[model samples]
Target chain A: MTAHAPERPAAGGSAPTAPAPGRAPRRRRSGAGGAALTVLTWAIGLAFVSPALWLLLTAFKQENQAATDPPTLLFQPTLDRFSAVLGADFLPYLGNSLTATVASTVLVLLLGLPAAYALSVEPVKRTQDVLFFFISTKMLPVVAVVVPIYVAAAELSVLDNVWTLVVLYTAMNLPIAVWMLRSFFLEVPVAIVEAARVEGAGLPRILWSVMLPIMAPGIAATALICMIFSWNEFFFAVNLTASQAATVPVFLTGFITSEGLFVAQLSAAAVMASLPIVVVGWIAQRQLVRGLSMGAVK
Target chain B: MSAATAPARRTAAEPGGGPAGRRGARAAERADGWRRRAPLLPALVFTLAVTQLPFLATVVYSLRSWNLLRPDSQAWVGLANYAAVLTDSQFLGAALNTIAVTASCVVASMLLGIGLALLLDRRFAGRGVVRTLIITPFLILPVATALLWKHIMLEPVFGLVNFVLSPFGAGDVDWASQYPVLSVVVALVWQWTPFMMLLVLAGLQSQGGDVLEAGQVDGASRWQMFVWITLPHLRRYIELGVLLGSIYVVNTFDTIYMLTQGGPGTASSNLPFYIYQRTFLGFDIGQSAAMGVVVVAGTIIVATLALRLIFRTFMSAQEAK
Candidate 1:
């Protein structure tokens, strides 16, 4: 399933068209040009990332220095803003966010793993139809159901509940998790499963002892992707939760009304809210492309 | 196979034979099918309950007049809300804005993404670091990204945009307030370009080196090779990127809410934000529900066509492998 495997050229294909002897001088001539292009690539990359870098810098600045004419570049960096954000009751929102994100991701894996296995490895009838059904749910706009969700939540008296978010986020991410996990399941060879079956290992035993060890990294990648989305999700969080169960994004909304008044404090809060997922995403950069495409590209 | 045969053999040995044995075997097979499907049931049932039920409720709600602010206003309206939604100037405006935002963001980000992917495809020093830097914006919280633009980067008096443009005599211009749609689009494009780039980069890396080398030997120019080979191979990846990107971007609310609040008079309100305003702010449940249904209807029409195209591409890709 890895797209990185290059196709083998035919036996006579490369032999007749071989230009290997000319390659050395061509490579030498292009060395300076390559270096120049690398520098340009580096510059563009930095420029593309500058806004996030600016946010990092602003988080360390004082209130006045954070938003100054000519955008204060040199300044005495301080930790006051972070302290201010923490002191201002930021922990509850952080706890709620962690609870929703972690709980939902775990739930998604629990439910999605078996479904993916059924669809890929053992494949009950109409496997493609089942896969399409899952992906179609993702295409259904969240706004279409928010009104009912809100009404139902109020009626059920769970409007500001963290568990409500956990459930909704599970549904939100389950489709992608299933698709991605299915792709991972497909990559596992049939021979291994047959070997386990031949050993008289039951379904549960085979999954626990043989399959999970191989699928651990894929599952971790799926979990990371789910956490990233659940952490950053604002639509449902803002509309559904109030003070009691408001997640990090909902806490950020508190700054929206106040706007330019809390520039440094806002940056500090944003940094804290985004840091965990950003670090996780950076660590799983290679898996991200696969996860984002629902493993279609890979 | 053994279980089916054993049952048949015993039944044949008994007096009441063929029909009874076939029926028993069919029943056993049905049970076996269900057993195989047991693992899929929990997810399927959960998804149906959580996702589909609310949608069903939305359709029912759209048919009735219910306003949270106006207690006792709940009554069967029979498509009045839908009619109102179709005629409402604000709804129409938001629909247009949604199209503008989704289209421009996807197109702009994809073009920029192709360029960035091409640059990263080549052997370069510190390429890993450069790729990491490029993808960081996407990893940041959307709310944070919106705030960064709204306050630090686009603020008139102390904005980074103005400061960088000061040498060109550009004054403190209120970019968010004056050009709300463009500001929102810029924020969204920044967040999405990395996604497009990653997909395109995967496509680029998956290319067979032998083919490109063959092209070089055949005296094909770089541009010719890219056009004839690279672009054709990348079509499916690009399609996937655009489809997925549009689906997410069309539901954009955080950027609108944090940056402009769809302000300067609803100039930047996409469908999701507009529906939020109607439901939460206006407390017009029936109207918003109707709008939601309309949005879904439009999405279904577009998605069905797009999904068919992508599904074929995906299946063909799978078969090719």
Candidate 2:
């Protein structure tokens, strides 16, 4: 979570430390060019982030204040909107979201880990066919499956249950998890495994005592991504659950009605609903970056 | 070197060093197979129970008329439901709308993300904080994000955007009513551009300096370098970005549904929202199921082709290496 300054080696112990001897002045010129580059980068980043900043600012204002003709930025801040959020079932919705996200993330990791290990280490017969089989499941539109899933849930009377969400979310996250963890597992050097086997460790022991530790960061990354996916998921949580098991996204909908919407209250709720994910992203942004950028790019 | 001879001496003592040793190796191979397979059971069961069975059941239900109000009356209707879905104007319109919305979002996000990535790729003050802020939209819950856009930000008169623009003589725009499709496209792009930006940035960062320097030394201008070197390297990442973005955008319900509920008279409604409205709101399960199957089939075809296209370069590059 700590933001550290990026350190480039000033003079390295390895490789040619300096650019070719006569190129110092050219490097100095490029260093000045880099200063100009920095300004351009900040401008671009700010533009990308403007919309979200607008949303955050809107959440802070009063209903009337937000819509003022000149839109006063220096108005005294109010906690009244935040108070309304607290007055509502904000804690309950937060709890529901936490339960759903944690349960789903745990299920995805537990299920995906072994499957990825199997596929990576053993190289099953017809492996490409099996890999395709799992990946292809994502092609099915949720709309197509929702009716049957809804009916089945109605039959089993688990429609509004958090556990039902856990089940669905586990399935939703497994394919990506398997793909991610398989790559991570593959990166473990074969020499280490051969050494472990020669030392008389059984397969299960080798996995638990060796592979699991090496892949811990991968597991964490996958788990964080899975948690975000589950936490932010709306369609399933909306269509499948009602009051009893409704997650925060559904709870946010309470502010919206046919008659009228309370903008401040809704904004407050939206902020609250988004708070956990924002916190998570803040804490684990590094992991999220690595996890999402798994594929070797350029 | 002397220790290596100890293994040979031990093998000589055992004297089972030919056919018997081969049989033992075969036995070990069989045992290894079971050992390797042992960890795979839970994942297979979980996937099958949660994903595979539900999907299979959806297919079955699509072919059957199972309105649980009369459990005993349910029976297979085959293509009748599919025929009904095809004939329904609402479903067809919704399908078109879905395609249009997804395509618009994919284009908008890709362009915006590429532009943003290009900008953010250089060194800058406050770059780290700026990067985090830019991705805040992606981290927000979808439903909450939609509500904020539709209500607080896009709410014609009281919305902050209009409030900010009013000083420059810009009046409030009825985002949902007058420009329904465009509104949804903007909202979708806002939510998803970070995804594209992150992937493209990853691609950009991986392009080592030597290649760009080589292009520079060859007397290439910055524009030419970007076109000839950078853009080509970004193809795979961009394709993956578009594919993943489309998959979500096509099925997106929360933002559009929350923002417009498929209105100012079905203007913003896409296939997923249409399917939900029919199945739940209109109580037309059979037709909705049929519509869903079509969506599934379409998605599968497009995804498969996109994956194949994106991987071709990667595959050939590997082979060449």
Candidate 3:
């Protein structure tokens, strides 16, 4: 396992060291075969991504053009549907999504960072048990508890409130954040921490001034992963929220019954709803693997 | 943070060396322990409050004969709901569907992910662009992905799937309705394959070149190297991918909801969706709660195995450094 460590850098750093010599020699050995493989890879990539690309294209097409048999590839693009979707009651749901995602991420960071710090830097007793407990909650299917959550929320009069979503989302993402952040915290050298302690730096000061700057990228990566999951979460949003605090996912539920009608409009709405996370995910692609793997890989 | 004051308090209380000093020292040590634990309490408490309390309520709800529509029909029916859930054919069917969906989705996506990871393992023109393209499906909102497949790709007359297959003499097929489970699986595979690919790609990239180069120096064929060396090296990664992927995919709801609604009559419904239907649509709170308990019990069996694998992977990685 230690042998694999040197090849795995921190997230968002760069490609692994193996790619340099590992591929160059192979390509040199079989140039034609490699070229054919590249082409095949490109073809498969295009085909695999075609659905998403088609969604984008349909978003820019007229309703009639969007659902053509041959799929109108060269139609005049338009933003009518985009404007139309936005002109509808889309902003409120978008706002709710933003509130839930941003607030929950912040909450997770606040709560998880300290917990991760305890688990890693200070070395809490039975740290493994605590960590296991956190992650095991993740294994508890949301469906199992949604009924009680709904009933409880109703009793508390917070059923359709954005804060309810915020709290739930925080719980949902906290385990991942704690695990990911703890891995990052572990990467902070023990020598540096010991030096800080020698200098009479308190735990809060050391965390705020010294370690935060070093693991900033990792924290951002963790936050991005949290945002992705929170934004994409549908079950809780759909079941819990109503007109007042429905998130973007709940907004999309309106399309479920629309069925064959408004293909272009549905595409437009889907594009807008998914665009933020899609771009963030693309930019943070390297970190995404580490986050999704709970930092087990890198 | 609170550890700063512990030494001060200790010295102020205990002077020299005796039983009293020992007691003071023990008190200070306990305080230090509490300080270490303080940072963890908020998250632990919040997780417990938000997650565990409801689950406990669900247990309580399971034992009661409660229906939302019947305001006066609430009473204790200990284990009756569980009996009904175990015997209900729909619940059994849904449990089976959940297994099938989770198993097939994880296995298929993992296979595709490995293949894609291998393809992208090498240097190539526009590799970054290609990787981004492959990953876009996963980035798309799951709801949107479901809608895209349902409306834009799987709709019979004008859908792109049949149109693309038309050249091969395939006729129009209403995919979501005709083959609900397959349709859901196709969309899930598209979305999840990228995730598996990324994990496998990480694994491939982490392979030490020295070992592979050693294999090459020994005149090992590429296929021989992949089978003998790369595949074995990828075992842990593949296991991690399958476990993590099943964890997420088993809770699939948005895809089934937006694409098939677990239909043509619960054919594609997994446990989550079925439990949701019983609770919300059927308004059978007690029965759904029972089903939820059953699902959790089943998940515990699988998750215990999964947790062991995950812990092994994580611990080994930690020990690696």
Candidate 4:
């Protein structure tokens, strides 16, 4: 096996000594040692990826093949499961999910962006206290809030309501959004804010014209993280909604009713329900760790 | 006229002496503060309304025996419900299960994550792709992970688990029925390991080149450099992983709900799942509310410690700068 480049050793290491013109770069490990590392890495990498790969394979298998006495590496693949879910009210659930995710994401960003600005840029006297408050809200497990909310919703006659989900989802995501957006906003150059101020722009104007453009990428990153989180949220979606307002996560539970029997169809629906966030997450994975870690790792 | 002129001129010449100008400045400062706060208040108020109000309600409800099922018997019970939950055998079992599951997942995921991160940090080919693949599990929806694990990965007849075991001549085992909490922990660890890996990977990459080179120049072996430098640097990352992992793991309702449904006599039910079962299924609203308070208390304890550690990490980082 040939050795391939791993990490760019550009980080936290001495630059390789300049290579003699006619000689191969000495930094390139080109012997049995390199080959062994390459094989080992592939083995580990493949092992890590096995579950997802198996999920995908199962998604494409026929029902009979899926629960066959021994799992088969090769089978006559079928799209029946995918086609079945397409017609199985997947779209409406998809719609509910999209509406809840998009609406709640917008709500979070609109509210969270300003709060983040205040916290990161022109912080108040009790900035840390305020941030801790936001984080602490998140730490309160949903179990604590769900019963009360359920009771309240029942009284308000809003049980199984999508609008309620939108509101609840917004609340669910707001704290993390504020924390993440604040961290992202802090990355904006103070010099730029000063330059705008020197040009006679006031606070609101500085935020609109100067900060937005400079921090557009950061905002996009924050928004993306928020969307992935809101999209993948399950507990609130399951607990709060009934048929009319059921989100994709709840929709997937229908498969569980049939239990282990619909292995193929279940895998297909699982893939579909997970695809949006999985793709979103993959696209935003770099910002994701930082965001989920509440910007601490960064 | 000259005396009046002298007073006015002195006030003007002092730059900020006039009460009117000082008042104007004060008003402007106040406006600035409001402007800064204007953007923040909407979110803070919204979040507080949601948490504080409902939390107040949760607290109030916990103090009463306000069960919808027994609506006619509604009465202020004053710690009776909490007393019930505290002494309930189910709550005790679930609490123990929570600790077992959370501790195992956090420790397993962090250790595995550290190993993968150290490996991926090396300068080799295909590391980027591998890193992405490693993150695949974390990216998948929690419910999907549970379903996939229960139906596909752990299915008795054909699950990947049994298939892998069969080569060693072991036949199918009803993993969930038999192992219960261990089965759930396995799935949780799979999903969470990537998150820990991401944290540790960030730590590994953040190491300063100069220090690494200096160590290498001093003929530091890989294990020595790792133990003396990398491990110490990753201390907070590991801690962050554990704390965050614990927060999420303690709330491990999704998997246990979908996978085992807290089955085999409530063997695998964590606290959140137990509370969920009580409130939604058993209709024991008062008991559930009491248990919810307990979960919140545990969460607060964990969150406070985590927040303090995270605060220190950032403080130490800024000090380093």
Candidate 5:
């Protein structure tokens, strides 16, 4: 779980060279302190996680007891809540979310890869300024652009279309994709690129046949983070999409109906909507830490 | 070997010393410079087209008075819309609320995140599981986060919070009703604390073992180690978290929208929600665009300062370890 460092290849050689004789004293000194620290961490960790636990419990309880006064902890488990949320025209919104997320992630990669390559490999004269400009685009709040974009979309007769959302998602994720990919690209040994260059390869050929192959894992990590961000995006999806392109978040928001039965259903829908991303996060824990930090720590 | 037999027209990137014997190489270098920028142009231009053009159009709209509901009533107002937006009571309230939400959420989350990261820095059983559990909130969907808080956790009557506090006879208090802004801020803190935790955790883990051992050998107290050594190394990372967290929290919309819809009469209306209400509900296109321009201006100022700090602190000392 802790091994996301780019110097991972060196660990194999450095492992046995460490001071094995000093390990016993280190372990002895940590005996009591470690026990107390472990218990404290467990307490705080569970406290932090109680919310998700509450959501899961709510998802399984009967509707009448889901939000009962003082709450009901132990109740008969039921699947009816899941059935309820699933019954509501929810699948289409899920599909729309998937389409926009997948398509936009792909588009960001298509455009961002070469840009990252240039920035890292054959940087322009003012590479930092260009990178700053890219980050600047991301810093522009959604409200600023949404106003004019809405007007333009209305003028172009393309409001409320999924394809429009595809475009919005791409713009929203592109700068971040470039920033992250550039950092990942920088971690590749410059010596390898020089070797590739010595083989009489042009820029495109080197990127395609050499850099891409070696950086496949980095690219996968980048793609996963992009997909996660796009999937969880709310502001653009909610504003740009209404009927035909409303994503899972918009669908999940429909549960504000405040009926007795809908509370449990809301929990069920929440669980289903969030399960995939949470699992993805869990599986890619190390890469996620690197991506979240923009590769600063890694 | 390459220099002897290869082409003499190497670019400036070839690093030949003193610009000595390369007449053709200079021209080639200049041309190569422009050529190297080719791969970056498409993405750059595409981003500009999609992002900046709309902002440009917004600037134009802000200068003129336009109403989506009454298209024919449009007329050039110059800076009048900006004047109105600046003077409006709701805008002031929303602006203050946004600052409050952002300041509180960032400060609280960063503190809590640092505490957790420090606690988990040691090797313990089930360390991976504990870290995963703590970081789970950040992975949940935003709208779902709002729902989980609004309905299931903080709803006053039927919430788990009340249930947990029921023994004290204070369980039935309606938190959302009493503290609408704080309610949303707390929920946001819950979601973002993990983000800060993850970043700061990486920073803590990255501390050099040799440096730490030297500190211990020098008979430094744990508190001294933290105050002098640990804190200095973590400043840039903490600042990075603040910058990123502020950017996200400033535009925090979904939670307020779902939880209270900015509630009780602009009590919880941050800038984004206020802007939403203006354009969609009031259809005051000019005023909303004006507010958006103000937001963009504010963001640029903050971003420039943040970038300078991050770059100065981190990149300059890159090889310190």
Candidate 6:
């Protein structure tokens, strides 16, 4: 019964506001407990994050240093690993990743926008059912159809093209993109759209001029998540690509030649491969959280 | 880009004029709709042409007697390929292994996610950084994750895990040879548990503090609160997470491909790896297609169930509200 937090009084229509009750004083008393709770929270958080920190630290050390007798924290730092990783066919892989990721993301947004708009503002019958249909695509395992996909790719001679990935990634990422963007579009306040329509503005015009700017942050977050998913995708990239079209992850596999696994070089490749996404994640961590949480925090 | 290109073409095709063009405008709008839908057509056509065509072809092939080794000697031997796949011990083992590994990974990750989410739910300093760090695993390339576990951490002597254990008289253990399935399961859990945590945490935060506070006011213990309220509230999310997570687990090839290659004696082969080996390595294209068909059919059934369950829960929640 207490679950309902008085819903945001319907947009632009102000409900009579009431003064604060006993909550202001209660917050003052809870401050000390909140601090302790915060510490416990951070401890739990750090414990969870330790694996990633270790992975980063391991990246900086030599292969032998990483596999040391005691797992050495102090190490002879070297840029040679970085240089070696950089000097490989790393750039082309990076290019492939960029092309596939950017293309797929843009494609998803383009197709998804109209679909979402039609589903929302147009009040199409069974829109929710249609929405559910869209989301259901995420349920099937890609590998189930992967063999067929491979055969298809080969037959079409799109074996390693970034465009092949672009298409597949678009489909793979479409479900979630549509799901997320639909919710965002729904939240854009239909009355405003109607107002724009009343003023002779069309749906596309309203979407471009009025709705998109307000929803830019959410849209960016969705695109970034799609980008990450596309970038990290390996099974398809590995199978579909051989030499000319391999992504960074595929190139990273070169470290495991028949001569045996080159642990040092592989680690270097991984570190370099993950750097772009990691940096992006770091800079956009705030936005990532915001988008991922579906604006629950706000 | 193809999808985007569709709309631009539609707009370009339509010329805006005054009231005289109003009737034409509606017709153009209809034209534009179909045109805009066209761009998505190639993508869909490609998906159907590739994935669907091969799928149907596989089904047909499954009934025929065709060996990749002698393509010219292929014959129409109805149901022999199916009988072969059904009777094969490797297929049976693979089916069982696939079920066991997928189940273990899903259940373990869900539990770990719950534990992590519960711990991370409290208001705290540095929570943002920790949150980002925890999700790092999900972001790491799967091949790299597999390689790290297979070569660096799970190596018998020098691997960090073994080195730490060796001091306690835990002698060198070949992960693939000694405990192949468990090794694959662990690697998968490591990669996927982060996903569950992320989803579950999002669910928990969205549930918010009010009902929890009310439960506390009623003198409910943490156990009672979770059992009576929190769990029910999170049921939909857990279902969604489990469903998506299972999809990832079942389809996973890179981990098994890189880590064990389903090897040391086919100990770690799941459906995907089984299909891969049968088709590419063993050159049993017909049987591989059969295996691929089975995997796809199985996945479709499982995914349908998961989706229905999750959707049913969501509907009930809406009704409750």
| DockQ values per model | 0.45, 0.45, 0.54, 0.45, 0.54, 0.23
Per-residue alpha-carbon lDDT of model 5 for A1-298, expressed as tens digits?
4233343442111122332232321222267776887888899999999989889888998888887875687888999988888889889988988898899889988899999987876677677788778877768998998889988888997777888888888888888888778877776777788888888888888889888877776776777788888888887777767888888999987876476566888889999999989988887777776677555555
**Chain A only: TM-score per candidate:** 0.89, 0.83, 0.92, 0.86, 0.88, 0.81
Q: Which ten residues in a row have the lowest lDDT in candidate 6 chain B?
A: B1-10
Q: Pick the candidate with the highest lDDT.
A: 3
Model 2's number of clashes is: 0
In terms of TM-score, which candidate is stronger, 2 or 4?
4
lDDT of 3 by residue, B49-135 (tens): 999999999999999999999979999999999999999999999889988988999999999999999988776778788988888
B111-203: candidate 5 lDDT, tens digit per residue: 999999887766567877888899899999989999999888888778888888888887476777788998898899999999998888877
Please tell me the TM-score of chain B in candidate 1 relative to the true structure's chain B: 0.93
TM-score to native of every candidate shown: 0.92, 0.88, 0.94, 0.91, 0.92, 0.82
- The candidates, ranked best first by lDDT, are 3, 1, 5, 4, 2, 6
User: Clash pairs of candidate 6?
Assistant: none
Please state the error at residue B314 of candidate 5 in Å.
5.3
- Model 1, residue pairs in steric clash: none
Once model 5 is optimally superposed onto the true structure by TM-score, how far is the C-alpha of residue B46 displaced, in angstroms? 0.9
- Distance from true position, residue A198, model 5, in Å? 3.5
Runs in model 5 lying further than 4 Å from the true structure: A1-33, B1-27, B317-321
Give the CA lDDT, 0 to 100, for residue A2 in model 2: 27
DockQ of 5: 0.54
> What RMSD, rounded to one decimal, does every model reach?
5.5, 5.7, 4.2, 6.8, 4.1, 7.5
CAPRI verdict (incorrect, acceptable, medium, high) for model 1: acceptable
Candidate 5 lDDT: 0.81
What range of 10 consecutive residues in model 2 chain A has the weakest lDDT sum?
A: A5-14
